[model samples]
Target: MVNKNAGDIQSLTRMNQLYEKLLNEVDVGIHVINEKGKTIIYNKKMMEIEAMASEDVLDKNLLDVFMFRESQNSTLVKALKTGKTTKNIKQTYFNNKGKEITTINHSFPIKEEGRITGAIEIAKDVTQLERVMKENMLNKQNGKITFDTIIGRSQLMETVVDEAKRATRTSSSVLVVGETGTGKELFAQSIHNGSNRSRAPFISQNCAAIPDGLMESLLFGTKKGAFTGAVDRPGLFEQADGGTLLLDEINSLEPSLQAKLLRVIQDKSIRRVGDTKDKEVDVRIIATINEDPLDAVANNRLRKDLYYRLSVVTLFIPPLRERKEDILLLTQAFIDKYSTLFNMDVKGISEGVKTLLQQHNWPGNVRELEHTIEGTMNLIMGEDVITIQNLPGRFRSRYQAEEEPLVQGDEGDLSESNQTLHEKMTKVEKMYIQRVLKNNGHNITRAAKILGISRQSLQYRLKKFGL
Candidate 1:
């Protein structure tokens, strides 16, 4: 009888261990509370997410210990009262640092021998996903904004945001450098909006747009007879006084104009056409260049002195290919915008369409993606899915060929026919084991506990799998 009882105890212990391993392997965070609302069992992720230390969470009130305000009116409490599973409960809680965090919580009543015990709650952090949702909300509210309206979110963009934020606190000349369609104007607008000069006028001028002969008159105020086009007109520099002046493609200006621009940036003064005297102006200069200013200087296309004056704080934006993550984000944003404009119920791109979108390199970056989405919507009909078939011929050709070749075996049998089937499933099993290890941040002891296996057993498997 003693030997029989020992065998039964060992069997039960192994079963319980397996149950724990399954729970911790899940991506979501889970916790259990007793009838007294005290946390009895919780996964490592649940504790770590709440910034708790050790296994001290056990036997403590889940709410008081975690210091979570939502626990007071928690849906988990409601689940415990009614003994019903709460399907979806959304709540936001602030961390110790006061940063708001949003999570989706699902709770189920725990039962013991057909009697209610306490409750189990699962929470998933939807912060990034929630941001996408909110961005969609904002997009619909303001349809006028396009990819051109917002700055990028790449590391380059993050640096630009940080610099713009810092620049807002001070008055400095900021130079934005990038290829055409790189959203230099968008950065300028963001900087202006973030600055104390937001209320002030934000005037912009394209130095390359104006004729070389009328450049002086267009930049500085002119007397009545200053030039053929001038009739007592105040130039852009004076018009942008006490505000920001965005000089688009500043490198395209003539070398003489570059010298004049340098003088204005240095002295905060400008000279009108046919007028020798200078007038004081307090405009903050922000310039954009599509080419390297150094190359322009070396080629004698731009003045060296002016390049230094305008480039006090230089920002370089990488092309779209370098930041592929932003491609789909910008694409979706544009699609949402154009959908409303065209008055179509076209919801979104199909999975195949999305795959094709990612596979091809976006040469034109955000601008090309925007135009492609718009063009696709216009040419395609109905509320049907936007498939790769609907894409432009040029874009479609990029993914026309098969992605991967099928494998074949000897005797004309398909390679899959000779597969080991269950044996070959080892790859997936090993992958899952490694994922669990990673989820536990490679803490072997904790991973073993969560996996419901002895630490020694887990170590043995790790060596067998060479993980």
Candidate 2:
């Protein structure tokens, strides 16, 4: 009888150990609380998810330990009180340390002989999962263009491209300076693709797109309990490990955040929002600015220190107006692209249309040219060549305005003796302003730049002449 009892005891002990091991090995967090809300069991996975140890929670009241607001409404409490199961319900709350936690929970009442005993809650950490999905989407949308598709042959553009190619040979940070729509992100991606880390991820984020409050955590990561609803998750720096991170519109970042960015660049390490330890990351940063970076620093929009670190290899992408020689080349490339995309018979732009295109300054650069071509291709049908009629309304109006004669009668008839000095001067000024405006695509900023006047001054003159 004694031997049989010993064998049975040993078997039960082994069974208990197996049960404990299985519970801890599972991915989901498991917690069991008695009918009185006292914690009865908490698995190892649960401890890790909560950023706590098992000893801290065992045999304690759930309400006392977590202090979850409105414990009566909690899934575990509700399941125990109502004797009903809550399956796959999503919950978000702040833990004791004020960190945000999100989880999909399944809570069930533990019963014996149809009597309520306790409640068991199973939670799956979804904060990390959601972050991973967001990063994956960004990766899918980046690195679609390469150097070969850049499509510019002007000396200014050639220099920019050459400098960009040279930048890819090293791991130093690159700063691309250009106006909006000048393909800064494209250059950044090309550099990444041409680098040794081409096989790794290429992540791009517009600094202006994210709110200032969330910028720090988004770029440097957040530790569990960093703030209300904060969860342990990797930031862009960590996500771009062994890869490239493109920060578009770096000047838009708040100055305080810029200082933090400088530290990250200098140290090659980032500490999560609530973390005490620094994590080393091997990421190549490529920052872009739409405005002159030095001007931005002078205006207090960007930190000077951050600028120096990021501009290790600055590549200045010339505005389309500055690279006028490449206008036809870019236009042809865009025409071919849109024609193939729309499955249209459009062969090319007419000489008249080409002349009109060359006359107008492209404020939006290559992107604007591509959009114009795409718009024209969508409207063309049964036509081999794009003409003035196929152009956008703005272009058509500008062309018509240019085509109109300056004076109603012959120039010889409207001699200097026919008008006063002021009248003749006013007429000439109006004509000159109109010509300048047309040349600059009616963009006040570019027109002002070419006219050697302030944009506000140009606006005043434009209003005066109604040009």
Candidate 3:
């Protein structure tokens, strides 16, 4: 009897301490009601949070003291009715100031002899969460990107965007080969954004910019005192583990380093510079080569083994000259950007300027065109419209001659038009196929890869065309 009495006293002391902690230290609002539905135990903070005094709530009928809207559900009532815990019950409750506040309520029933005695209710403020959810819904409704922020509407650009989205669905390495200014980085970013690894960090390194000696350290990282001026640092591969690492100008990698890159791609692991310890990484590699990678391999500038591994899902972006329809669309976008930055009131491009833009062959592609327009905007102060007179002098005269209509003699020269549509298609197909084949140095496997098709499919076509 003496031992049982001591144990009872210890239990009572612990319960009292728990009650005191809940009343004074807990952050959430807590309320306890008796079998008669009258307030038996409630926290001072709960009253202060509701902007009411203890006298206004203590010993009062709990249901009568608080007002609720008809739409608002009661977890405490449900807990009492069902004799179970109700979790994450959401509703809006009006404070003493009559302002509606959102909350998530949790409640549990107290029972004795299988009969419901009372219910304990706890409320958590969720106004911030509610606002965040609403804003996310609005952003979704607006059809804005939650990832890549690329903006373009041209059909060619759309195709590139679609390919980037498709690339994200696979874990295979993607090779984006394009001209210097054809938005290779944008495509890489879009692929990362659309991927499952978007939440992780995305790292980009320009292989052409880094020195041969430090390339390995930059890519695979190094330990402290691994070399001169070397502190312990995680390399791009370790930093981007479970995410993506884009190697821009990959063809520029030294032949020695290319072999190392191939091993990383094949094994999905890395060994830091001067460190014998090998570490496993799951980095998704995306490489961009401005030049023909196969040509680099042929000249012994790039390793053939690494070239094959990095060209898993190859995508080639056509130059601006080939996608002429996108020129005006990209022009307007660049104009809008420069207009905002330069604080100009320039409205639109004139008819003459449009004709000249359409006729000119953009050798430098999109980047050159944007720079030219930006330079033109700097020269003109107040503009009714951007005319041919405002354009760069070299483009104005050379391309201006191509815009004029030809005479009857020129119309009769239809030799170029006399070719049948089938013949024209064959010509285009042969040219593109030959380019791919030559770029891959007659390696059908590499050619098929560069063209983003199967080797067997290429073989069938090559046999059909007698090439």
Top candidate, metric lDDT: 2
Q: For model 2, how does the per-residue alpha-carbon lDDT over 440-464 read when each residue is reduced to its tens digit?
A: 7888898888888778566645643
Q: Lowest lDDT 10-mer window, candidate 3?
A: 410-419
Q: How accurate is candidate 3 locally (lDDT)?
A: 0.75
RMSD of 1: 26.1
lDDT by residue (tens digit), candidate 3, 73-138: 566666766788978988766544444456788899899898989888887777657666765665
Q: What overall lDDT goes with each candidate model?
A: 0.73, 0.81, 0.75
- List per-candidate RMSD values in Å: 26.1, 22.3, 18.3
lDDT for position 307 in model 3: 71
- TM-score of each candidate? 0.54, 0.56, 0.57
Summarize candidate 1's per-residue lDDT along 178-250 as a digit string, tens digits.
7777677777877776777777778988888989977777888788776565587789998888888999988
Give the better candidate number (1 or 3) by lDDT. Answer: 3
Candidate 1 regions with alpha-carbon error over 4 angstroms = 1-153, 402-467
